[model samples]
Target: MKKQMLLAAMSLAILSAYAGAAPTDKAADVPLKPAAQQTQAAVWASRVLSRYHYKATPLDDAMSEKIFDRYFKSLDAEKLFFVQADLDKYADAKQKLDDAIVGENLQLPFNIYNLYQQRFAERIAYARELLKSKPDFTLDESYQYDREKAEWPKDETEVKDLWRKRVKNDWLRLKLAGKDDKAIRDMLDKRYANYMSRSRKLNNEDVFQIFMNAYAMSIEPHTNYLGPRASEQFDIQMRLSLEGIGAVLQTREDYTVIREVVAGSPAGMSGKIKVGDRIMGVGQGSTGPFTDVLGWRIDDVVALIRGPKDSTVRLQMLPADAGPDGKPVTIALVRKKISMEEQSAKKTIMEVRDGTVKRRVGVISLPTFYMDFEARRKGEKDFKSATRDVARLLAELKKEKVDNVLIDLRNNGGGSLTEAVELTGLFIDRGPVVQQRSAEGKVEVENDTVPGLAWDGPVGVLINRGSASASEIFAAAMQDYGRGIIIGEPSFGKGTVQTLINLDRFGQGDKARLGELKMTIAQFFRINGGTTQLRGVTPDIKLPTIADAENFGESSYDNALPYTVIKPAVYIPAGEVKDIVPLLEKKHQARVAKDKDFQYLVDDINYVKKQRKENMISLNETARRKERDQQEARAKLREARLAAAPSPDDPILVPDPKEGLKQAVSPKPASAKAARQAAAVKGASRTDDGLQGDERSLAAELEAEKAAKNAKDVLLNEAVHILADEVGLLKTDTRLASRVLPYTSDR
Candidate 1:
């Protein structure tokens, strides 16, 4: 699932702007009929899914209803455009979509989509009319922005009222950001105009993709249908060469939102673009005028961002944390290929002090389980693999005389099942890493055949909500074997395996391309018999995180596979870490109770939860301004407190593959008085500084760097300390030490 989503996202990143059927000037004239190949493709897809999909779901009345509801939800997720009358018009087709799919009939789906397009056009036209005059911001009213669960409007009048509040809220947001009325009106006019223009570009292929995906997801979230263009892009990504800004994008409403930044890619290196940031405009070269991208298709925006290597693309972005009153910031990056080396495992050392005893703990950060399959297939000995890289790092850490090793797998969306098994071998001598169960109930165990311990010292594995698939496999094995203590948040539960099926193979020589289907084939079970399907590997020591598991992981998806258990594989436990987990948890709790950074993290988590629960915002300008002021005041207070606290003396050591270890310079701690002085200087400069273009971009970069320096890795630091506590406990208790591998060093 992870691989497929990334491939789909990267395809959007690398493809040129889609030039579909010539756009008609009116939305009513847009193509609403299925293409010649769609009928055959739909039939083939249905047959393959029913015969071979892992879930064995039948296309009956129950499933047809799900498809019908899902299709409507996809088109109107926020329940903004459609009304009760629109749904009533097509109520009879709710239980017939399944038959439609099998019979290769797509008229109903297309007809519904055509009506949606008309409603969408009417809404945009209304919004454009609303923008002609300024809204009365003094009215004390609130807008419910998130209406995913809200009922459809009973009448057109009700929807119009909803739009009135929406438009008012939008205008007030800009006003609070210090934009004048003229600028706000002009920007909104262009935005709504773009919406109308893009709606006319929708073609038959787009409608088919949406309806088919609705059907696919009703069976399983992992299964999806890729159109011909998307399939071609997926094949390109499989070959491992890409040129773009290296960011994954998804359309949210009318905006193209950044979902993930590929590490070491142009966008990631810039340190300015981040997940959840909205790309409002795009520009070419160094001095091109920014083109407003609001209400544009996500793929079109991606095309504007992607370019040839060494070319420059500038983006006007709204920061993720910046609320409705936030101003847009521009960032420029040179396009380049995302390098494999950047995603490789990296080693760092953190010195943790427990009272007077200081211990050197080695940290291995694995972003993904990767291997050079082509090179290895060609019998190349120097091919890159996570296990090989980690083994070399282990040898170097041994030379450095580190006492414990912590494997950091946070945000590691898994890759390469073979690499995961081999990587787990680095910690344990040899064992059954994970078990795979086919749809026919056939179980197969993958083992580490060539194994001696790479580093047998005390070990820890750190994970979070973003850690998934192969990452979960490795971490679960480590926990099950008693080889290490698992720490941090529960991982993303995605144990189902997927295989791509080419639809053209079943086309029987028809000239049209039939696209492809990503089908779920099997589920992964841990050595201890439990599957990481809906319930991912739970950490022994839970940490505070801002991400809500209910909204972020596999359990959040509709119709996800359920968790189950099988007969446990015969295997030997490697250590007695489980017996000492209580003591470790006590120590961890005691340490973080007094840690100010930890408290700040808890506060942020609470704030996010509260905001998510409310879902409504005041449209009154005064209330909005007051809320923004309170937020800024709290942030400043936190900064002051952080400035007043004593800083850690230890510097992080990053190992250079060619030059051994290099000490990273830590940011100097700032005193409260110094922080105040710096703020004053910044305030004074804002009045006189007339910085423009590249100079302004440089200033933004510097500000981002300063913010990054202040953000501490509270979780990783705590993990290091917990490992140090374990090492300390083992040195004094001979009985406890006997049950675990004795720390050894060749130095």
Candidate 2:
């Protein structure tokens, strides 16, 4: 089911908050409901404990009492089964156990554990009943394109209701999958057995997470407490490839939906799969009747999607935004292992101009601060990491005569502590990149080493809510140091460092235990004085996106630690962005008022919100067909826009720059028809809209193309005019920069 990682931002209002999100009550604070005052399982547990462990003992009463306390306290009292009546029943069980043990009945703890199984099953049966209830209106938030952190919802109830609906839908989905009552009970029993048999050491981590969440939320939202197992999992998630089709699936309304495809992954590469695509059915192996994966946990979906590498898996995706969503698209993909070498650090160079001056800007996108940890631990000096490769890429781009750069740290979740600090070093002349503070409050400034400033030119750093952790640190440092102009929406505030500890190290017999605890340790502060804690760095020029909402900020992150300030560091003032804010706001407003891309994003968000709010849909074929057509139309419209837009420099250029890089570059197509379309774009580029100064005829041709619904032709014509502004110049001579100046930001 869709796991709601949300919290009410306004709760307690403590800057440094961690679980329940904002600081407040503990497990004991929220008293159990009274209706479950006499739960049978609890009563049975008491009897079992007394009969087995305390039989014939003079201290049976006291022993049974203490054991019972541990038992109830150890249980997740919030599991809905532990109401006041359950507690009373547990107390009765304890008394019964005490009496039974006084008579030396020995088969107790196992029986009690069995009782746990029975009670768990029965409780689930009733919960299934509860789930048939209608779901609440939901406006869910998820990871932003920047990947720093999750965006928050506009309303608290919106997310809370999302969770409720998700749970309810999951119940209905299970029933619809043809699992009768017995099958459901058997499955639950097995799951329960697994939990009980888990290492006690592993289970203890739950308590630690609860405690750390309460403690960390106070510091900041991005600061996470990684109990060991979780940290390992986090590492795997950052690469945008997780052994599946790379779909961000979650349960929404009554369906498990495709949130968004990770860029460059299999799903993202498809161009056909998109955000809001829903998974209605999943066919495993060779296939038969489609098995519904809707309402399943993300983990379960992964299990269903994964297989031996190269094995084929069929997926039924309902494309959102592309159609009305009636019929599902069945896609079969062979699973493969994807590593950072394939997923991150994609770069391109774009040529733009302001009148007669042509400027070549390098755009580099770093997905995450990737590091080959396994390789590093083995002392592989050449192990790849973000800093290592990014540094090299910068050097190469400079060689290619790039005058300006756009470091696209969009969805880069931080990785490799050293890499973040080192990456920051590349932009600044020489100074502290970030600050780290310990629990005792000792702060140390982290300085950038091995840097004379990578490229001192006007730079723009693009970020969004997904730009978290190390990305935030880098952005904050650059902003503080006045190195570049920060663009895009506010970032996800995840400033805290998490340490993962393997429970297997401590629990020798717990190899089967997959869970680990992640705890927060260090907090990040900027060199100037502000912290990237809960409130991540505010960009110099804010760009609007669909990821906005008060709940999307740090305060909305559960159990986020509080924020506190320390002594300000003495530093030099950087350059100012004086009137940039107004410029940005104006530009964004103007764009939002007319830009179709901007409008489409808003529409997509609203559509998702609607689905999350709905209960169910009619499964009629006619309705499905109509929905499908609508979606296809939207998809075509979007594709038309993209196809008409700017095309990238030919990939063949790097290897053969000496082999005629001067002519107009055409778009790459996957097939012959696409190649023909590319040829048409190139043909249209010949008549200089501005290049050879054939402005009149070229403009008329463009206008005619537009009138004829040839947007691609028109866009290519426009690009020709734009590029003609600088025709004969090589990479640098006239097409790039004419002067060198320092890029400084006003912090």
Q: Say which candidate scores most in lDDT.
A: 1
Report the Cα lDDT for candidate 2: 0.48
Q: Please identify model 1 stretches exceeding 4 Å from their true place.
A: 1-29, 194-203, 232-240, 243-341, 355-357, 371-384, 510-512, 642-646, 649-710, 742-747
Backbone N/Cα/C clashes per model:
0, 70
- What is the C-alpha lDDT profile of model 2 across 1-747, one tens digit per residue? 111111111111010011111111123112222111112222332332223211112335555565454444334333333334445545566755445434434234334433444444445444444443443213322211121222222343443433344343333233444555465444434433333332111222333333333222323333234444344345453322345565545444335566546566666676777656777777876665687765444344555665666777788888664454477889877666544343457555656553456466666767667666656667878766777777787887888886567677754556656677878878766677778776667788878767486766556677766567787888887787655567766776766665443334433254433233343456777877777767776876655443433435454555455666776666653444332334444544553556565455445545544433342432333443354456557666666767674433211112325443222222122122223332332332122111111212333544654443423222222222222222222223321222112342211
- In candidate 2, position 264 carries an lDDT of 65
Q: Taking the tens digit of each residue's C-alpha lDDT, what string does model 1 give over 151-264? A: 999999999989989888777766776778897787667666766776776778888988999999899877889887676555443433456787867665566778668777
Which pairs of residues have clashing backbones in candidate 1? none
The TM-score between candidate 1 and the true structure equals: 0.78
RMSD (Cα, Å) of model 2: 17.2
lDDT per prediction?
0.75, 0.48
Model 1 per-residue lDDT at 744: 37
